[model samples]
Target chain A: GIQVEQSPPDLILQEGANSTLRCNFSDSVNNLQWFHQNPWGQLINLFYIPSGTKQNGRLSATTVATERYSLLYISSSQTTDSGVYFCAVESRNSGNTPLVFGKGTRLSVIA
Target chain B: GAGVSQSPRYKVAKRGQDVALRCDPISGHVSLFWYQQALGQGPEFLTYFQNEAQLDKSGLPSDRFFAERPEGSVSTLKIQRTQQEDSAVYLCASSRRQGNTEAFFGQGTRLTVV
Candidate 1:
């Protein structure tokens, strides 16, 4: 089993500010993804990065598989972005594997 | 469907009762997963299914927890003799591929065992 750890357990940012969230995994992974759990408890998919960089609107993510880490960047933060951001990874295994998620970084964007 | 859909968004059950949670993945999805998330905690894997087959269930916390996807389109997670510890948010996800792919998650069902 692979372990995932997220940094900055809590974060508060002003509207329009930028922030970076980090996720470190213990073992090599087949793929990784970023998710946002909204205030209503809905899990929203953010990004799916296995070993590269991807950008979606104001949010972007980069995964360095060899080093076993992934970073999620949020620019021009909005109050709507206030929620828990999670990093989940699928361990490289022969069988169908599930994503193991980190505790997550709770982000609060104040307008 | 537009995305993964879970039924009975919230449920409350007695300590010794049985509870069943249902999840409907997106159409054409080949992989489905079930996970549990305690308050303020990340989601933990519970089971995985590929089509109608229950491929991996090693993450199930105990034997009392069981899941089924007989038709491979819908899934149901049943907790027998529920305990307080069984109270949590149950999440379901689906992906088009089997090994490596992005999984779309449902809103989740919040269960409370009193």
Candidate 2:
């Protein structure tokens, strides 16, 4: 099974600040996604970037498949952005295997 | 239509008792997955289903855990002889295809085995 590791286990940022979260995987993956678990426990899909970069409003993500790493960026952070950000991956060799998740980066944006 | 929906937003069961959780994936979705997340921990895979077939269940923690998706749409996860260690949030997610793809998750059922 592949292992996913997230960095900056905890982060606190003021409104309008910018921050970056990272995820590293132990093996090559065919699928990679970033999710935001809101305060109410809804896991919102943020990005599905197996490779390259993608942006959605104030959030963006980049996955370097060759390096086995991915990054999530938040610009002009808001109180609404406070929650847990998770990175999950599914390995190519593992057929129909569920996605492996990282411990996650807990972000708190204070207004 | 709705995204993945889970019933019994929360459940409290006595030790050694059995519990069942339900999940309704998005309409027309072909794949479903179940995961467990302990407090302050990341979600761990429990099982996966492609349509009505359970293709992988290697992540199930023990024999006490079982899941089913007989109609390829609605799914259920049952835990037998529950223990305190089984207390966690049970999350259900679904994707459109069988291979690698984006998954939509439900709000999850928070179960507490007392």
Candidate 3:
């Protein structure tokens, strides 16, 4: 089984600030996604970057497949961004594998 | 539906009781997944179904937990003789493809076993 680890388990930032979250996986992955869990417990899809970079609004993500790591960046964050951000991946070496998630980075954007 | 939809957004059950949670995935989705998330923790995979076939259930915690997708569009996760430890948010997700693709998740069912 592949191990997914996220860094900065807890993060607090003032509104309008920028932040970066990191996720490291122990093995090769065929699919990787970033999700933001809102206060209502809805997992909102942020990005689907198995590899390469993508940007949507104030959020962006980059995955280095060869290095087995992914980075999510949030710029000019707002108070509504407070919640948990998760990185999940599906191992490429496995057969019919489900996404494995890291403990996640709890983010708090304060005004 | 525009996205994955889960039924009974919240549920409470006494110990030893049985409960069933339902999930209606996006139409035409080829893959469906069930995950369990404890408070302040990320979701953990429980099972994977590809077109009505349960492929990997290795993540299921115990034999008491069962899931099925008979028609490939709807899925149900049933827990029998539930214990307090079974209290958690059960999340369902669906993807358009089987191996590699982006997944959309439902709001999830928060289950509390007393």
Candidate 4:
């Protein structure tokens, strides 16, 4: 079993500000995804970056697989961004494995 | 369906009662998974199905919890003699493939065992 640790268990930011969340894994992973769980509890897919960088609107993520760390960036944050952000991954050597999730970082953006 | 669909968004069960949760994955998706999320925690895997065959179920917390996907498109998770600790949000997700693919999740079913 691999370990996934998310930083800043809780975060609060003013609207229009920027923030970065980090996730560190214990081993090599073939699948890495960032998700935003809204107030209604829907897990919205943010990015599927096992490596490299990807940007989606005010959200972006980068995963440095070699170092076993990933970063999620939210810019010009809005109140709607308030929720929990999760990072999940599966080991590269584990065949057809389910993604293991981090404890998640709760983000709150206030106007 | 455009996405995974879970039935009975919320359920309240008395202790010792049996309950079943249903998941309808996106049509043609090959991999279906069940996860349990406790309050203030991330989702934990319960079982996984690659088509009609269940390849992994090591995450199941107890023998009382069972899941099956007979035809491979829809799956059901059954919990027998539920206890208070069984209260959690059950999430269902599906991926296009069994490996190296992104998973789409349903809204989830919140179960409260009293």
Candidate 5:
């Protein structure tokens, strides 16, 4: 099994501020996804970046597969962005294996 | 449906009781997954099915948890003799492909065992 580690266990940011969260994995991965679990317990998909970079509105993600790391960036954040951010991945050995998730980065964007 | 749907958004069960959570994945999706999320924690993998066949269940915490997707479209997660430790949100997700696509998730079933 691969080990996923997310940095900045907790973060508090003022609305309109920019922030970045990181995820490091112990092994190579074929699939990587970023998810946002809002205050209401609904998990929203943010990105499915296995490699390279992708931008969606104020949120963007970059995965450097060779480095076994992924980065998520949020700009001009809003209070609605407050929630737990998770990074999950599946390795090359994944056959029927489900995604392995990191502990998560708890973000609180205060209005 | 446009997205995955889960039934009985919330449930409160007495210890030793059994509970079943249901999930309806999007049409044409081939992969379905069940995950358990404890308070203040990320979702943990429980089991996975590729269509109607359960491919892996290595993440199931114990024998008390079982899941099935007989028709390959809807799935159910059943926990028998529930314990307090089993209290958590059960999440269901489905992807268009088996292991290489984005997974759409349901809101999840919140279970509280007393």
Candidate 6:
């Protein structure tokens, strides 16, 4: 089984500030996704970047597959962005298996 | 029709009771998954189904936990003789394909076994 590690276990940012969350995996992965779990317990998909980079609004993510690491960037953070950010991965050995998630980065953006 | 939907957003069960959680995946989606998340913890895989056949269930913690997807559309997870440790959020997610696709998650069912 692959181990997923997320950095900055907790983060507090002022509105409009920028922050970077990182995820490191112990093994190669075929699928990688970033998710945001809101206060109400809704898990929203942010990015599905197995490799390369992707941008969605003020949020962007980059995955360096070779290095087994990924980064999520949030710019001009808003109060609505406050939540637990999870990074999950599917390894080559676990075909068609469910993803393994990291503990997550808890972000709190104060207005 | 729009996305994965789970029933009974919250449930409280007496210890030793049986509970069933339902999940309706997006129409036409082929892969469905069940996960458990404890308070302040990330979601952990529980089981997976591809259509009507369960391809993987190695994540299930005990034999008391079982899941099924008949007709390949809707799925149900049943926990028998639930214990306090079963208190957690049960999340259901579905993807269009079985491999290399983004999964859409349901809001999840928060279960508390007292």
Q: For every candidate structure, what is the RMSD over all alpha carbons to the true structure, in angstroms? A: 1.1, 1.0, 0.7, 0.7, 0.9, 0.8
Q: Model 2 in CAPRI terms: which quality? A: high
Instruction: Report the C-alpha lDDT of model 2 over B5-103, residue by residue, as the tens digit.
Output: 999899999999999999999999999999999999999999999999998898899999999999999999999999999999999999999667889
lDDT of 5 by residue, A1-111 (tens): 889999999999999999999999988887899999999899999999989999999999999999999999999999999999999998877455678899999999998
CAPRI verdict (incorrect, acceptable, medium, high) for model 6? high
Can you write out model 5's per-residue Cα lDDT over B1-114, one digit (the tens) per residue? 999999889999999999999999999999999999999988999999989999889889999999999999999999999999999999999999877788889999999999
Pick the winner on TM-score between candidates 4 and 6. Answer: 4
Worst 10 residues of 4 chain B by lDDT: B95-104
Cα lDDT listed for each candidate: 0.94, 0.94, 0.95, 0.96, 0.94, 0.95
Q: Rate residue A54 of model 3 by lDDT.
A: 97
Clashing pairs in 3: none
Q: What docking class should model 3 receive?
A: high
Backbone steric clashes in candidate 2, count: 0
Q: Which ranges of candidate 4 are over 4 A from the true structure?
A: none
Question: Chain A: TM-score in each candidate?
Answer: 0.96, 0.98, 0.99, 0.98, 0.97, 0.97
Q: What is the C-alpha lDDT profile of model 6 across A18-65, one tens digit per residue?
A: 999999999888899999999999999999999999999999999999
Q: DockQ of candidates 1 onward, in order?
A: 0.88, 0.86, 0.92, 0.92, 0.88, 0.86
Per-residue CA lDDT of candidate 6, range B45-83, in tens? 999998999998998999999999999999999999999
Better of 2 and 4 by TM-score: 4
Candidate 2's DockQ: 0.86
Model 4 lDDT at residue B50? 93
Candidate 5 fnat reads 0.92
| Model 2 chain B weakest 10-residue run by lDDT | B95-104
Off by over 4 Å in 5: none
Q: Report how far residue A77 has shifted in candidate 4, in Å.
A: 0.4
